[model samples]
Target: MPTLRRTHPADLPPVQRRELWAWAGYDFANSGYTTVVITAVFNAYFVRVVADGADWATFAWTLALSLSYLLVAVTAPALGAWADLRARKKFLLAITTAVCVAGTAALAACGPGSVALAIALVVVTNAAFGTGENVIAAFLPELASEDGMGRLSGYGWGFGYVGGLLILGVCLWWIMAGAAAFGVDASAVVPQTMLITAAAFLLAALPTLLVLRERARPQPARSGLWRTSFARLRQALLESEGLIDLRRFLLCIVCYQAGVMTVITIAAIFTEQALGFSTTESIVLIMVVNVTAAVGALVFGLVQDRLGHRPTLAITLVAWLAAIGLFWFAEDRRLVWVAANVAGLALGASQSAGRALVGYLCPARREAEVFGLWGLAVKLSSVIGPLAFGAVSWASGGDYRIAMLATSLFFVAGLAILATVDVPRGRAAARVADAAIG
Candidate 1:
């Protein structure tokens, strides 16, 4: 019988281990924003308070997310290509991180009925968050070998869930403890929580900037940024025969990610509105979900290396379909908790598997550019999913259950498309493309 050996920090050279921790630290840092601002806290606040229960709050909130993702969809590939050309992934990451932090902090000023200001800030912050996600993910190919990519990506995602858990825990405490802790009125809780989230992001993200070195060799100067970016984008889209499988995989990601993004963006809002959960209850529920998600990422990440990326992803999508079905019919709040945990498991598995597969399929020399395409797929899903949900919710007069049912179609379609991907063939293409570039 053959025994399997697990990789650990001690198994890596000191420098690579340090880089791994740093890379994971950024996940930890940015997850606070995703948890507190985008997924759990702010979305609920925006709908329930900022927009004051208007029928259009869901629409407006989803629309803001759509706009932000639209911006990322348009510019992520260009910016990623330019960053790769310049070997400036870290630089771009820093700039986007700053934008997110500043925008989140500025949300502190948005008092009651400040819907316009809140939306604008969310757009700016979310766009920066999406851009930064692409840049950081492009580093995965540089950091881990194909055999280790799933575990490494899972580690980062697991760490991210811990970050979300910690930050959400704090926010929950603050919200539950009430005005005495922060010396502010009850109404100020959301703004104060936003400030805490921003500070957490800034402080936790420092290790990445300080420790993760860019390893890519810069190519000689190309045509100007715009020309080169557009040319590269066109080539990646239309000219790279090796990327055909990768392109198909990305299309699969587009379909399922729409469902995933919709769930992430609106789960808290759904719990609040559909189940009559209070602010505190929603925060607590999300914190629990984060815990399960972290466990799922770590467990499935290890499983992915053995089972292969495609199988792992397919399994998760099936889980997603089931979870969404539960959400659609879950009249009792306890059932929502069950659905939340199911979603948590699927969320972690899908994210870790997808990123690892992309790392496996990306050519060595074009990590940023290829991952930019990955980002474009993700951002496009972000746009389409939220907009679809928002539109449905609006048309149905905020019938979130119907919106959730609609989301499951995306998962089913994605799973169907994903079945056709040839993982080994995709990997071979990536290697061939790398050799040609070399």
Candidate 2:
């Protein structure tokens, strides 16, 4: 297995406050993309307008996202290894961010009967977003101590929700203004939200580009970058007994993150379809949910660092299960709102804790590559979870309630796998691996 020659954990560079915030800037920058385009505005628009409410529209949307995820799952691991080898996480971060911004901007051209244009743009934009997400997360272990990693990650994630809120809040105001002032309907104004989100992302990413420095030293260039990456990744996974716990935890991530992604991809559309929420109502619901999620991530970040990553994560999983149950039996919009809030609370913590735990278990010098693998795991869940939910909905003739309830199985599976992991042991193994590589 490839590993970095490095000093002990305490000997690493001290975290700079400016750099830390800049690092978090990427999170803040990108949340708007996911929140506005995929979760809040565009997905519903594609189904209701782009496809003109076709029966297969929901499935098609999920397929588009899953296809992007599939491409990431195939490419990110190798790219991660390349970034680690070349010390190019930031450079690659720039490329992916640009791709996402341009792709999201391109989404504005899609209106009714522009399903192909919409799906194609979504695929490119989301793929770029997912890839960049991996590269940015690779910075986590470099910037914070194991004890503080969860808290730091939470800060970024929680702050990211605020970013999402800003963009969505703006979109809401714009939609209302267009309705009242120009007498335009949502369909006419929705395209502008895409432009708004893309511009916000570009602005938000500037801090990270300017201030967040790359700490990983480049490896000696070797023959065949792709081959080297895959070989190293394969060797590491196959031979590193130290990472066994991390491997198990990855399985847990796959299961639970599926549930997370499913909810995110379907939130707005489900709200409108199942509970009679208008676009305005769905935006309001998600805005409130984002607030709760922000609180959850920040509070749980400290709690995880104090109580331990595993227990805190377990708590969030329990919350997810409860939320799923509530949504399943919800007979009214009020009940659905309750469930959405419950889910919002779990959303950030579950994702933040999972990523932090992976960082904890990762050996020195393997941050990007492992996170790439982590991205692969997450994208795989993205492919499976949302696609599964959409499939169930399609198969059941749009029985979205049953589809939503069935998602509980993912969290349950994640909980069962999570029980088997030993957190302290994993961290110890990582330290030992770093020393061994050195």
Candidate 3:
């Protein structure tokens, strides 16, 4: 018999590389929807135009965000467990992606004075997007080894920011020139922009469906989705004596992610309402942030491998605290631009590091189930952070600066918890778990 040859690390097969790109492509595809629909264009448009310029616009927008996340928080873990047990991550991802694309397209019909329709669409689309995020993340450990996981996760995040920038640029150009260049009426600009967003998401996501393959084996049948999910979750939390570090690390993510998500959800509105930025200026600022964020994700992702996930995350959280401080003190509109870039760096690094850490810590057999819990932590933050920001804004009579500063406490709290996590211990535990399962 002929001797088999071992492939070296530097000589990974082209097939593997292609699959990696396809995985990253999903991030690129969905980011367009996030940047234009959720983060930048439509969010502002909904508050300014669709809501008829209500005094409570900021509160209402944050409330809607909270509700959408609440839905995700309640369902993500059960769905994740079900997908894992059934070997259906790719199938479910497709269904959720379709929901996001369709709901985004329907926003074209939500003209001004369609606040109810706009809210409904945002809620549905956001929930779908959040679910897709969790499912897509479940593929991370399968795509790259732990040694290179940081780089791969970072690449995905970097690609996502690039996609966000490209889509935001397209929408900005349309808004600036649509009336004269495309014969679009000013009244129809926002609605038409929603159509553009939907198209971008649908087109960009095609590669993921074509190229990405599921690697999970179907687990034994369980009594029910919720029962299996809860049992597995409980096992990971309580029965596994070695997962204490994992448990602590997840709690840390919940605290810091609250600050991170609040900043992302509110950045556009804060700039528009407090600093008086025009629609074009706000989009441009976000574009600049995206450029820096892509750079940050790539740079910090490499750094994460060398410095280790815990140290890298702690540094990112400090950056977050400083950025929030700048937002609180920024009076000149230009100063807000500076803060935006700082926040962008922290945003990319923290997210990339967090995902890599979880990929490192989770057992291979439990990728979907564990990442589902990760999604749960993130969704829970979405609910708490936005609600807290909205409440502060409402209580302060819409003093968004105070509300923004309040987010710092979450970063500080998370960092305190992160300092205690033993990275090597957690990783060893995960390996042991994987061995037992194997």
Candidate whose lDDT is highest: 2
Backbone Cα, N, C clashes tallied per candidate: 0, 0, 0
With candidate 3 superimposed using the best TM-score fit, by how many Å does residue 399's alpha carbon deviate from the native?
A: 1.8
Q: Residue by residue across 137-179, what tens digits does model 2's lDDT show?
A: 9988888776778888888889899899989999888878877
lDDT of 1 by residue, 91-138 (tens): 999999999999999998887799999999999999999999999999
User: Which parts of model 3 are misplaced by more than 4 Å?
Assistant: 1-15, 182-187, 222-226, 238-240
Better of 1 and 3 by lDDT: 1
Ranking by lDDT: 2, 1, 3
Tens-digit lDDT track of model 3 for 137-239: 9988877777778888898999999999999889887887886776865545878888888999999999998788777778875587668777877787677
| Candidate 3, position 360, lDDT | 89
* Candidate 3, RMSD to the unseen true structure: 3.7
Span of 10 residues, lowest total lDDT, candidate 1: 1-10
- Regarding lDDT, does 2 or 3 come out ahead? 2
